[model samples]
Structures are given as structure tokens and as C-alpha cells.
Target: MEYDIVMEPPTPREFVHLRSAAGMRERSLDAARAGIGDECAAVTIRADGDLVGMGRIVGDGATVFQIVDIAVAPDHQGRGLGSRIMNELVSWLEANVPPSAFINLIASEPAFYEEFDFETCAPELVGMDLTLPTESESSHAQ
Candidate 1:
């Protein structure tokens, strides 16, 4: 099946839904609302008019950019939808972002992203992250 790749972020509702459907971490609607449409570049794929894949680049528009939210629906895995999404985002960055700008992403599958020239930052630099507790999490901790 041919998928339509659109050069735009998905709606907040669609973003939340597809993120979950793709087994990515769950994001609240409020977070989605605050995040969607803020990307330097974004790509969304639709199959038969239903959103099935998405990717985005975010950061300070000048010197830093991070690719995030790369997803493909479970049923759509094994297809090239994820690659197509990355192709669009990378192309946009290549055309627009400065050569000196830094582009990065946190990848679960390093092999996959290595195809796009992403290298591991281990042994030399460690990647760390922290997730702020949600209201329920905070209440439960007390």
C-alpha cells in the first residue's frame, strides 16, 4: 500500500494516539499540545487517510536539532514508512539547518539510525535522561 507522507506535524490527538500505538512512551494531551507544531521539521504518514507514522526535529532552531517521535504503526512495521519519514526530516534539515548545527537523536535501535549516519556516543560521552513525575506519580510517592 502506498502511504502519503505529509510535511507537517500531526494533530495533538493524533500525536498522542500514534505514539502509544507505536509503543513509544505515553504522552499526555497537554504535553502533546505544547509540543506539536513546534518542530523545525516534521513528517507524518497516512495510509488510507489514517495517520500511521510520524517523525520530527526539535531544538533551538539555530545551533542544535534533535530528531524525535519517529514512529510507525505496529501493523505498518517492516515497511519503509519510518525511513520515508526520516528522509523528509533529514532532507529539510540538510536544506535549512546550518552545517555547523548539531543534529542528534536517542535511538532504541542504533543500527536503524546508523543508516542515516547517527553514531553512538558511548565510552566518550554518556546519554542521560530524567522524567518528571506526573501528578498521580507524585501523589503516589508521598
Candidate 2:
């Protein structure tokens, strides 16, 4: 199936649904609504008018940037949609971001991103993250 890739962020509902459908972690609708438009660059791919793939670049935009939320629906995987999304993202970064900006991404499959020249920041630097507890979890703990 052919897809229409656009240089824009997905709607919050579409963003939440597509991420889950792509086997990624679930994110709250509130979080989606709050965060979707904060990206410096975003790509959305749709088929038959349904959003099927997306990628985003988020950060301070000037000196720091992180690629995030790259996803493609399960049924649409392996058709090079991810590559298309990445191509749009890399192209946007190349055209818009400054040469001195620090761009990064956290990937489970480093090999996939390596195709785009993303190297693992190991040895010299380690990737680390911390997920904050939800409201319910915090209340239960208290």
C-alpha cells in the first residue's frame, strides 16, 4: 500500500493510537496533547487517510535535539515506511538545524538507526533514562 508522508505532527488521538498499535509503550492522551506540537520537526505518514507512521525531533531546537516517537503501524511495517519517515526527519534536520546542534535518540534497535549514521554513545558516554511514577503510583506509595 502506498502512503502519503507529510511534514507535520499527528493529532493527539492519532499519536496515542499509532504508538500503541506499533507495539510501543502506552502514553496518556493528556501527555500526547501536551507534547505532540512541541517537536522541532515531525513527519506523519497516512494510508487511506489513516495515520500509519510518524517521527519527531524534540528539544531546545537551537543547541539540543532528540529524535523520538518513530513508529509505524504493525500491518504497515517492512514496507520502508520507517525509512521514509527517517529520511524526512534527517532531511529536515539537515536543512533546518544548525551544524553545532547535539542531536540524539534512544533506540532499542541501534542497528536500524545506524543506517542513518546514528552511533551508539557508548564507552565515551552511556545512555540513561528515568521514568517518573504516575499519579496513582505516587499516591499509593505515599
Candidate 3:
């Protein structure tokens, strides 16, 4: 039987649900608001009208971009929805981004991303970040 998979650009609220359901990091409403904007290339899959998967390209349209928040709901996992999402995001990048643009992503399973030409910059380079302590935690530290 064929499934009804409708892919569309996701609204802000849908991103929140998709991210949480897919086990990605949570963002505050304001932070999420800040993340998605005119420059973003995003796609969401609706299975019979329910939002089941999503992916997005975030960063400067030309200089930098990151493939992020690729997620399929638990019930929808293993049906290749993640692959479909990546395909759409990569298509967007291919059509819109120039050669100088750098596309990056941090994947739990790097193999999945490798299918779309993603490579780890390890050894030659490393991914790093600085997480700020929450207010309560900082107060305790003080």
C-alpha cells in the first residue's frame, strides 16, 4: 500500500513538535523563532495530514550552511522518511548554494549523512562548542 507523504515548508510551531518528537535538542520559543527565517531552506513531511518528519538548512545563504534537525517521528521511522528529507534538503542546497558555500552537520549516525555526501572533518578539523551554564546552575556555582 502507498502512504500519503506530503512534503511542505514547515511553520514555526511544527518545527517545535517535529524536533521534540524526533529526540533533538529543545529550543526556547524565541530561540526557535530566531533560527528559522527568510534565508532558511526547510521541508516537512506530512503522512495523511500529520506532521511526521522534517529537515532544514540553516546559515547564511551563500557562505555557510548546516543541515540540521533532520527527524522523523518514532512511528514513522524506518520508512525512509529521513532519507527523503535529506534528499529534499540536499536538492535545495544543490540548486541554490554556490561552490564556495560550506555545508555542515553533526549526525548521530554519520553513515546516514554519508549517503548525501556529508563527511566528518575530523583529524583535519574538529567540531567544538561552548555551552553556557543556565542561570540556576550559574547561581549554584557562585
Candidate 4:
């Protein structure tokens, strides 16, 4: 199942659509629209111009930077698109972020991120929320 995967930088519009299709938590289109504005840059993988994978770096672009929205379409999963996206993001961080800056992500898969040098925060040092109140409310209402 080899396909021609091309990695290209993502525009905000394309990022929203691909993120939605990848089963990401639903966000308002306006929020998604505003999200990629200036603060973040994304890389997307496409096959014949159809999006297959994407990842983005989002934050203040200085002191606090978090990697967010890394996703690959189901059909494209098992290939190296996620790694490719991470590599690009990390490279960007290396070239751009200062040594004193903090980079973080709430990974979908801990093991996968570990390969890229991301480690889990120590339980004693950090608190985590598995689901936000809004997400919980939405689930309960449904």
C-alpha cells in the first residue's frame, strides 16, 4: 500500500479540515481559524494533494511552546508520517526556540513520543486532566 506522500507546510484552512477528519476534538471553526494565526506553524503530509497527516507547534512563540494537533488519517497511520511531522516540528524548535524556553505536549501515545525524546512529566511534578469540564459536560449531555 505504497502511496506518494508529500510533506508541505499547512495553511490554517487545511489544518482545520484535516484535524477534524482525523477525529480530533471538535473545535469551533472560528477557533480553528484563529488558532493557526501567527502563533503556530504546521506541516502536513499529502498524497496527490489530499491531506494524510499533520502536526503543529502552538504557543507564545517565545517562552512557552507546546506541540499540538499531531494527527494522521487512519489510512495513513502505520507509515512514518507522524515521525516526519515531529522531526520537522522539532527541527523548527531547535533552530528557533531559545535554550531557556519550555517545550511540551500532551501526547496521544506516550511510547511514540518517547522515541522523539519527549518524556512524561513526573507524577509528583505535574498534574493531569484526562478530560476537560466542557468535554465531560458534552459527554454527559449526550
Candidate 5:
């Protein structure tokens, strides 16, 4: 099916639902609502006025920036939406962010990210963390 990908800033409600549908555990409705107000910017693709894909950039706006919440609804996958989102993101970064700024993302699909010049950290520089913090001895918390 043909889709008209519209790129625009997403509403808080749309951000929450799309993040959830994308299986992103790091973001929550409250967090997105709180963080996406001014500094962060997002681009969403709508087909016939219905949201189908989205991508977002969140950061302190100077030294650090991370791409987050790139998602396309299941029925809309494999149709170049992902690439469109990444292209928009990269363009934004190139236009606004400084050369010394740190741009990063935790990609769900490593292969896809590589297409946009994102590479896995070398073994000596790799870092990983759990989205949920552990504060107890026996049980994990989210």
C-alpha cells in the first residue's frame, strides 16, 4: 500500500502510544510528557491523518543528544519508513548540532542503524545498562 509520510512534531499522547507499540522499555508516558516539551523534537509520519511512523531526538541541546523512539506501526513496517525517520533525524543533527556534540542511540536493530553510520562500540568501549534500576537484594524492579 502507498503511504504519504508526513513529518511533524508528535503530541505527547501519540509519543506514548507509539513508544509502547515499539516495545521501548526506557520511555514512559509520564517521562515522554515531561521530556518532550521544548528541548526535544520529534518527527512523525501520518498516513491519511493516522500516525504510522515516528522518530525523536532528546537531549540537553548542546553537548549531548540521543535519538530515541523510532517506531513504525507493525502494518507499516518494511516500507522505508525507518529510513525516512533516520534521514530526518540525521538531517536535523547535521543542521543544528555542533561537531563536538555527542550523538548516540541504543538501536533495537543494529544492522539498520549501521546504514546511517551508527556502529557498535568496540569491545573495549562497550557499555550496557538495564532500563530498570535494581535496589533490592532478591527482586528486580521496573
Candidate 6:
């Protein structure tokens, strides 16, 4: 009942699949194409040639960076695979990101991220997002 999982860079398609299987929000194909391949840091956990977990860091290498899309397949959850993914990601950031760089991540479970020293930015500041609806989707909603 044991499988060997190896960590490596993820392909765009694998990134999309991992995100979905992990129950994360579905991202646009265009965004995945543009981001995953060139992420400042990326890690893919592959079990038997299938992607089972992933995480990435993106943004300008010098001044700002965000850790995004940390996911582990539902079938593989509860095994600390997500933590392993974070370890790979944080290790890379620690070794490479500039001391002045602002590292951030929007954690579904703030407690999970807090284990890695990510503090909750509450009261004083909050994370916000503006998702511009697509032409068809917006029209349909009205």
C-alpha cells in the first residue's frame, strides 16, 4: 500500500489536473499556460507517473513573491504530502529569494501555513481579488 513519490517540475497539463484533483478552484487554461512553466519555484509530487500534489511560487524574483496553488490529491491527503510540498517550496524560497522580498500565500487553512511562519494579516490588511468575468459568463449571469 506504499507508493514512491518523486518531486519535480510540473507540466502545464499536470498542473491543471493536480489542482482539480486536489479540490482547488479551476483556473483558466490561459493562466496555467502563462504561469506554471515559468514559476520562480515549482514542485510536483508524482506517484507512478501521475501528479498527486503540487505547489509553486510566482512573482518578480527580487522584490515580491507569492506561494500559490498548494494542493494534494484527496486520495492522498492525510499523509502530510501537502507539508512535503510546502517544504520543497519554502526551502527553494529560503535559498533563493532576496531578504527584502515579500513572501505571501493565501492559505485555505491559515493554521497550515502558519506552521511555516506565515502570519495572518488581519485587521490592518486583508487579501483581496478581482476576477473579471469573461464576456459570455458575465452576460449569462445578468
Q: TM-scores of the models, in the given order?
A: 0.96, 0.97, 0.86, 0.79, 0.81, 0.89
- Residue-pair clashes per prediction, in order, are 0, 0, 0, 0, 0, 0
Give per-residue CA lDDT, model 6, range 77-137, as digits (tens): 9988889889888898889988988888877899999999899988777898887888899
Query: What 10-residue stretch in candidate 6 is worst by lDDT?
Result: 1-10
Candidate 6 segments exceeding 4 Å error: 1-7
Per residue, candidate 3 scores C-alpha lDDT tens digits across 1-142 of: 2344343556677778778888888766676677665546877788677788887787877899988788888998999988988988888888989999888888799999999888889999787768788779999998
Point out where model 2 deviates above 4 Å.
Answer: none
Model 1 scores worst on lDDT over the 10 consecutive residues at 120-129
In model 1, state the lDDT of residue 122. 89
lDDT of 5 by residue, 1-142 (tens): 6666554667778877876777665466676777665645678898887788988888999999988788988878888999998998898899899899988888678999999998888675665666554347336433
lDDT of 4 by residue, 45-65 (tens): 778767788777878878989
Q: Write the per-residue lDDT of candidate 2 for residues 1-142, one digit (tens) a residue.
A: 7789899999999999998998898999999999989889999999999999999999997999999999999999999999999999999999998999999998988999999999988989888988899999999998
**Candidates' RMSD to native:** 1.0, 0.8, 2.2, 3.9, 3.4, 2.0
- Once superposed on the true structure, which residue ranges of model 3 sit more than 4 Å away at CA? 1-9
Best by TM-score: 2
Can you tell me which runs of candidate 4 are displaced by over 4 Å? Answer: 1-13, 127-142
Off by over 4 Å in 1: none
The candidate that achieves the highest lDDT relative to the unseen native structure: 2
Summing lDDT over every window of 10 consecutive residues in candidate 3, give the lowest-scoring window.
1-10
Of the pair 4 and 6, which is ahead by TM-score? 6
User: TM-score of predicted model 4?
Assistant: 0.79
Query: Which residue window of length 10 is worst by lDDT in model 5?
Result: 133-142
